[model samples]
Target: MAIVTTIRRDAVTLPAAELGPDNPLPPLRPLDEMHRIEDRDKDDLPRDMARQIGYEPLRSLLPARVRDGYGRERAPRELDALVIENDRLRATVLPGLGGRVASLFHKPTGRELLYRNPVFQPACFALNGAWFSGGIEWNIGATGHTTLSCSPLHAARVTAPDGGEMLRLWEWERLRDLPFQVDLWLPEGSDFLYVGVRIRNPHDRPVPLYWWSNIAVPEECRVLAPAEEAYHFGYERRLRRVPVPSYDGIDRTYPAHGVHPADYFYEVPDGRRRWIAALDEDGEGLVQTSTDVLRGRKLFVWGTGTGGRRWQRWLTEPGTGGYCEIQAGLARTQLEHVRLEAESDVAWLEAYGPLSAEREGEWPGVVRAAEERLEACLPRERVEDAYAAWRPCADTEPDEVLAVGSGWGALEVLRTGDKLPGTPFEEVTLGDAQVPWLELLRSGSFPEPRRVGPPGETLVAPHWRDMLETAPARPLTEYHLGVAQWHAGDRAQAVRSWERALPLAPSQWPLLRCLAVADQEAGHHERAADRYAEAFDDLCRERRDDGETWTSVTAALGREALDALLAVGRTEDARSVWYRLHPVTRERGRFRLTEARLLLAEGDREAARAVFDDGFEVADLREGAGAIDELWARITDEPLPAHYDFRMRPAM
Candidate 1:
């Protein structure tokens, strides 16, 4: 005979020991152990493993005020009965996704549906039953292609108490045959409904358990996340048009800041999931109540988009806001760990839908809990709302409600009109026929006719043998051509071309620098030195305005340029430039030490030591100056040189 029993009539008692701490996203193993449920096997699992779990686990971190009217803190009872909703008799459907029956009477168990009627691919199983094939295996669960995991067997059913008719069962074939309209429901008017799931770590070592919930928010509403406080990789390009905010709320301030508003992912590690009042502009709120950081299993948080071509939208269009993805895991990056020897899985997920329009008097003391949770995910005082368009009220009118949070409200609004404009860098249009002057020079194809006699015959000997004297392109282009000519062993022609380019071309730093080098190559030492001197002076002027301290690399480059100028017979110019930099160089630690070497070259031993003694302030100069001091000591035993070879270098 089969054992028969009715729903236990006795008031259900929970063992005090089973009730874990009142926290967001509580662990599922405690409940599973109490109910004697088998844990889920770590075989091929789903991608979006984080999405399989609901958002309820994060609720425990909510302010006590907001967590009110939810479930009471209770211990687990020995012999727990996992209740399953069997039919749609009392189920209620939400606003979107028509015909998808939801168990309205049953308070969400906080346990989410993981693999329902899963169909396996040749190698894997579907995690979210959408795009990805889950983490481990790629199983196809579409109609007519039902697959099941070989290990950690799962069973589902829709039935009344013992001896009652079966409502439904977790069978792939059966679910396919039945309409998607079917839904499981909790008893009528139940304040809280509890569903349990088992996480089986079949492996010898522990694997991570991850999950996420698909909570739908209104299109008009926005999301908030603490990007400045949290490590955020800007917007997901795949989900651009998808509805949702980039970040979850940072805190309960008037307006938020430091978030990119587009596709961005926010990861909260285990023991870090906590936030309060995920509210919309119209005041729709979904607060996190608890989180179960399952040991050895990482929790993933995700915000899905309703519609878009890519995973994230808003790279090109900042106005296009997408969903916010809030997740908890062992690591911050996409996927952290999985061992062949470990057992890890995402267990439960619950979504509390659109709350009452007016939530009054802070739910209950959940503020501290919520604040703590925020601390785990981000630093204190970092939470902020999403970026949105701001509209100011008329200044002429003295309004009452408008003045309440107006001071903050004004700052909350993000201005969209001030984006930096892009500039086009194409050549000015002359005509469809554009001349390729650089190409002409490279090809050596001068269009000007060759010297010919009066009879139009090629002259055996021409009055002038200069075939190409004028440059065909812009002055800078011609300058480049001159450099190429010098490399090709045509020094005279190169020098002539450079002379033409110098005055015709505007003084762009790059061009001026290049011209200076060209003059040096042409052996016009005086001209090269003058060019370098002019360039260095200009750079100093530019940097002086910004008060930017010069780096060792930059200072070295500048010194090298100065040396080059002095080498080219512009010693007086180099000295003038050097004097201007002396005060600034004295302020710099490394430059001051290097200045000592310059002093030694000038036969000023006392001056060199003065700088070396005070050069400790120049952090980069200490080692070299120290080495020089040691060498100086050795050299003191012998007669010091009248003048040291302090190689002067030019400034870049």
Candidate 2:
């Protein structure tokens, strides 16, 4: 039997090394140049789209208003890199670089538990661009790395309640009007580093937020977790299933599996406390265990194949070995949104450390050893008690217009009339006015309707039109009205509304896309093609200016533009727009299929076949065998496979 040692707070003593001026790491580059994408064209697509819609570009829309304090460039300064250490373990924090954990080292084995990039190399992989591929990156906000990932955070060195040293990193999330803080502590003699995160909504209304911790590790590691299945979206954002960690009982360790590069979000069973570890063949590596608040674990691997190698190069500098990510999420999966109510905050703790096996055949013993230590560090009772104490109080207000609450694995919003049975509601009789819940939700606004209940999708146009007539000249309002009109099938009215909205928010990519769609539907193919091109260009500019990356919606709009250009016989323009898309987006199987279709239409069967083959490779990577079969069916004029859904359009 193997002996397991549990560390306690009182038994440990602090190490001698201190985090001060004398032990600073390299200073970050200037903010202006840090996140910028190079070789981008100086085309103002938003301005051109605005002109096409018969409006001038709005000055107010030069930079996104939601992102406060983001447009201005900060002066270069030498920032300190803080470190917390014990006799066995050491952790470093880079405050200037999103306060990321720069390095986690195990002294006895001289191993780096977390991948440490040699320099701050910002790449265009995050929703808000500027993502560095090493260390544990804190992502908070809608999706991807939050707007704060590349920005400097306020830092402080404090003493924990048990007299342990801690490094606190904090900042206001300007876009969401929330304040978030992270406290990192390395106890005196423990081999683990603890992380505590708090995100508080300070406003009167509720805000939607998403958060994930992306921890990078060496590619030659095997993830150990007790999940039976993994979920990922393949072509067209359709959900696809695959086995976790392995497909055929054989462990699909990194760089060893025949599977294509893909994102894997494992579904953890309910009521189970899960711990995830990424260990090398020698059974030595990092382990992450968290409190109940974090319910999901994910793996992102850019495989060792050609496409994977290309992506690895795109994310990091040359000669830097590729890495795999072990991620943890606040929700059941990535891309799911949660709400933080007014004055409410969510808190959770995560502990990371080194784990090693006693012998090669005793790898499971290492997992058990880590789990025992983690259980001792953060007992289930302590976590539950902390949650009970910190959980938000229920809302008792009767007249609240939009009540936001979170439970049952989703963020739920209730209007007065939409309340469930047994819930309290005001008796005052409000009129027959309805609210467009979906539209309002998408627009990031609270519905101000006279009555409750859900509104009809077609009725959204009239509501927004009425609001625009009486309300102030709000660009967002006008934009909402245009979306409503478009959805309601009032194409001309939608175009007109977008025309009015463009002058107030020219940089709004969705408005440009809406206009382009309207034009395309109206048979103005040339105009639509030009507008689509403009929209894609404008999105690229917005990313370069704001560090935003390609979203599914934006990617769809780009595809639409490409199709429109091809329809108008503007093949060159279509090709140019296709090239402008992010390399990640362009590598998708759907986009490759589109390219192949276009080549085939242009009477180049050989080129089309080659493109189709390339797309087939990508499809294989995405586990999109169904898509490959569909493409073959289209090329050979044969019936699609029986399981394939013919009615469903190909993913944009």
Candidate 3:
């Protein structure tokens, strides 16, 4: 019933249109300029100027005209790519695109399971700024795609002892300065593709990290998972569970019904054999099963609204089709930082491919068919044997294996030091630096203020300074340095350090607030307003323009930015900023109260009263209820009541 077009894996190439001047990929930021931008302090600029500076490096720097119609007339050409295949499945890897699997085809069905973007269209989506929207983006070291997501990776094709070809892709995560590698193994006569990854923390200190496997699928698809409950990631890091697929008057499952888009983190109930799929209405899709190493799965849907469609267009070309992400995480959930010990390593195995289905909407039949195919071709037993045959780390043997069982999947080593008493695996040897750093992190003894002598003689330890100097130039390091400098009474240097750090870790509201407060304390009200405005923009981006209101440190900063702007007599700027904040922050009561106050300041009592009536609707959600009353009393020209604190705080 379905027409199929078979694409030869060998013939596929980077389309000529994608390579020419018209469709120019973002020119790589020069190393020196990148470093310079990384180290520059951005807190002093106005809000718009600061954003431009923050986002410019992430763009192609070409005029809009040049980038708009860049690849419209180009043709496909053969490129030097890594093609791995078997009798039933084929995958093409592009070493240039962070070794992403550019094309994955189910040979029998001739269906391209993974969404392959026709061009290397880098956009401002990733946390580190530049990101592409196709293929399986290997995200490690952070929540979003790593800084190198748009860059090339070190790749090599090697033959396993069993004579199977393996494509190895590796890159050093510049942000965390960690080494990570993913090995793609497609055994002969198999339809499923096995992926094995190892991430190593080569430092002597414990480092916080995250790992996510982001696989893109067609937009008009449903995410299938064996999840009974789903956690909705909300503003201010709020996570609450709702029934799977739908809850709280919201249908989270795709082909989403509501206007508000959703990002759901599903906790895989079956620890032994967890799997997830992205299938169409007819049950045709790709199924991914991972060993117990990957504990969490996430679904990101941008919905079919105008804004969502526009964002999808920005990510790819118009009519090229939009895609959603079915992601897997190493930790319980993304943004939940896991501490990796020094000189330590973690590895996991996963397999994915097309599911065979006989009828429309037959979820069970599709899953059964996929399992049968997996069993017939690359069974769990075969996977374990293959993984055990080729050990990943040459210098050491796995002392402890973390896996479900013999036939569940490949064994992974999550922890190395001591083997469980009844466990089957051997104890892994660890580097000498591992235990101390682990202990330090566990005891919360990292870079704390030290008492050098008697009372009031406290100062940041010299070792913290030493670590700051030698650590990778990352936001975390800069933050620690700023804290140390601030406590050491070097406020100006601390502000500068935090300013440099803010752009690197834009989502950190506390850091931004700290810089803002420092400027406010130093009598730089305009600079303080800029810092708060920048923080507000970061929060807006993090919330993805959907204005479901929740209170967080960033939300607090948004309120402060408004007050600071008004304090400096920048009424127009305050009004402009408030409009941008209102849609995303959605603090209806707070926005109304602010609007009323601004109107009253401009001698508009009737308008202020009208706003006050609207504010009363959501008064219960307002944090500064007393402040609202005070504003109301003032607009009515009434006398102030007994001592009242108008200082605002986040409604916890």
Candidate 4:
């Protein structure tokens, strides 16, 4: 049958909470930043591998601000979706949600190749925040889910490799200041969906790059890759080599066989085809294979543990069958970041489709049959050739615009005058957040706001920072420059910049928070607490609109402030800040944890115990967080409940 591809507009209405608005306050330092520099030497990794692991630590997320502004409160909302279909498959892409392939349905088989998350629940999972679970997600730029996980992407209908209509999703990744595009299309009568990805570094210097295609598959499936030994990274913050299928008497290849959440990065040997799959007992499931450049493949299991299950429930709704992630990336592990030389780019093609394991033996026979099926359906040569065919199409201008993403990309283009041919970040997309930065680029001066409010987003790219440094010496200029410096790992300089801005700032809270972070890092706990207290006070007293937007601000800032105050034995002060928080905010799992800490600090052990007894779930729990266990120990001698246990490592 002749191949025919078509792309059309569609809608998917799910119970999704509004992303509200981007938090104006830049997150100075966050907890996950500490994990970026894991003990590579301790892991006994090769020196070359260890160097890549610690290549470039993500010091601060300045250029892109924190996105913890969303809440659990949700309502039915229709989201813009783009559907691309061929004879054998149909892919429904959510252009509004990072161009996520919301559904990949195999027509003949009537099977969904990816985990179709039932609801849209925003959790603090992304690097910025507000990441939802589901479908095939394109993760780029450093570790964790991309900041764009919950944000929109620039999508358009473009010509495909086989003269079919293709859907193209493009975005300028803010973290690495790189432009990338994803081209998705289904060939004529082909069961596999082809995705071509490209990441470009348009700078004079080399940049650290990370890319991963995260496909969520049903938890019941057994994941198989091309390697026997895998790098195991558990919540204990340790990475060690271990056998694949069986680890500690459990066939961990089956997602639920593990006892806790962990990562198994398959060690695909050199010259071997890169692929990963999640199939059932009969060997029927999805298989993802990519060209050589995209080398790494992984299995991320949430495990069968109570905490893991609880987290699963927290992300969406209960009874929505559990899931585990099968991902492929540009490095051996997500911890390592490869260097993309100046003016260079990395591109590859990936094919995702169903596999039928016909052979009857054990692990080896099952995987071999699946591999043969994969080769029959979509040969490796065809994939490589399809990539060659798509290269030119990747640069083809979109025929029609389907959706628009953040204008941060356009602003960067304005500042640099760099012409991106296919992935154009049009100036028309420029919005409120990019306005001030626009002025800085055009007029060579960082303009102050008409009235005092939270600081807008910061720009930490070298070029943007240089502009800020040369711009007029206003407090606002110094403030953002300090943020850029802090992001660049210049702590002392960032402190000086914030201190200079403190005297004449329009909003003292933003500057105060940054300074407090510096103070805390310097072991000036008392000073840090005082600064945090003042910052929270400034925010509470400031004139604000009555909405969840500001409510998010207070909750975020208040939590940071409360932690600081409690660190210095200021339980009363912490309590006051906690009370000033919105009732809804106070009820959140994180804040509830804060409340327990407050009660304990004030010598009210019983009250603290009750806080835990109330039963709460921290939806945004860190991957390897031991806080719950530690806090539980502080309150009583009783064993921690299963639901609260997220310890990823075996007890020492």
Predicted structure with the largest TM-score when compared to the true one: 4
Model 1 lDDT, residue 571, Cα: 51
Question: TM-score: which is higher, 1 or 2?
Answer: 2
Residue 485, candidate 2: Cα error in Å is 11
RMSD, candidate 3, Å: 17.1
Give all TM-scores, in the order shown.
0.25, 0.55, 0.55, 0.95
What's model 2's lDDT at 515?
76
Sort order, lDDT high to low: 4, 3, 2, 1
Question: Looking at model 3, which ten-residue stretch has the lowest summed lDDT?
Answer: 403-412
**Candidate 3: tens digits of C-alpha lDDT, residues 1-652:** 3222121224455544342112121111111111122224445433443343343132211111111122223465664566777777778876665667877888888899998887555543444345567888787655555555555565554444255556666654644545666777766666678887777775678766678888989877777776767766532234456687667665565645534344687866664456677877776888777777687788877666544564565556679888888888876556455667887877778787886443234444544565565566456676666556545322232232211111100111222333222122222322322332233333433332132110111113344455454555566556666765665567788778777876657445546766877888789888888877766666655543332122322334466778888787777777766676545344445566677777776678899878755533221121113465467677776533222222222225
> Judged by TM-score relative to the true structure, which candidate is superior, 1 or 4?
4
Q: For model 4, which pairs clash?
A: 3-188
State the lDDT of candidate 2 residue by residue for 1-652, as single tens digits.
2112212211112111111111010011111211111122113222332222222111111011112111111233343566667787777776766777878998879999997765454443444334557889998765455655565665555444345445666655543545666766665666777777787664567766677988999887777654667665322343346665556564553534634465677777777675677878787889887777887888776655544565555445559777888899876556455667776778887778886632223334544565565567556565554334322211111221221111110111222123321122232311122234333434545344343211112223244345444544456556656655554456677678778878767465666776776676567888878788887777666644222223433455666778788877887887787777767657665577778767766677778767754433231112223444555665766553332322222335
Local accuracy by lDDT, each model: 0.29, 0.55, 0.56, 0.85
Q: How many clashing pairs per prediction, in order?
A: 113, 4, 8, 1
- Give the candidate order by descending TM-score: 4, 3, 2, 1
lDDT of 4 at 564: 90
Name the regions of candidate 4 deviating beyond 4 angstroms.
1-3, 33-43
- Which candidate model has the greater lDDT, 1 or 4? 4
* Model 1 agreement with the true structure over 1-652: per-residue lDDT tens digits: 3222112211223222121111111111111100011123112223333233221121111011000011112244432222333321122221111111122221233422121111111111111111111111111122111122221111123332122321111211111111111112233322212121222232344333322222222223333332222322222212111112223443312222332222133333345433323445544444332234321111112223221212222111224343332232222222223221243322322122223233222322333444444345333222211000000110011111100111111111111111111111112321111233222334543333232100010100011112133435556445445544544446576566666766655533334554676676567777767776776665555443333223221343355556675455455565566666636443554455445555555567788777644534322111001334343553255532322211111112
Better of 1 and 2 by lDDT: 2
* Model 1, position 405: C-alpha lDDT score: 10
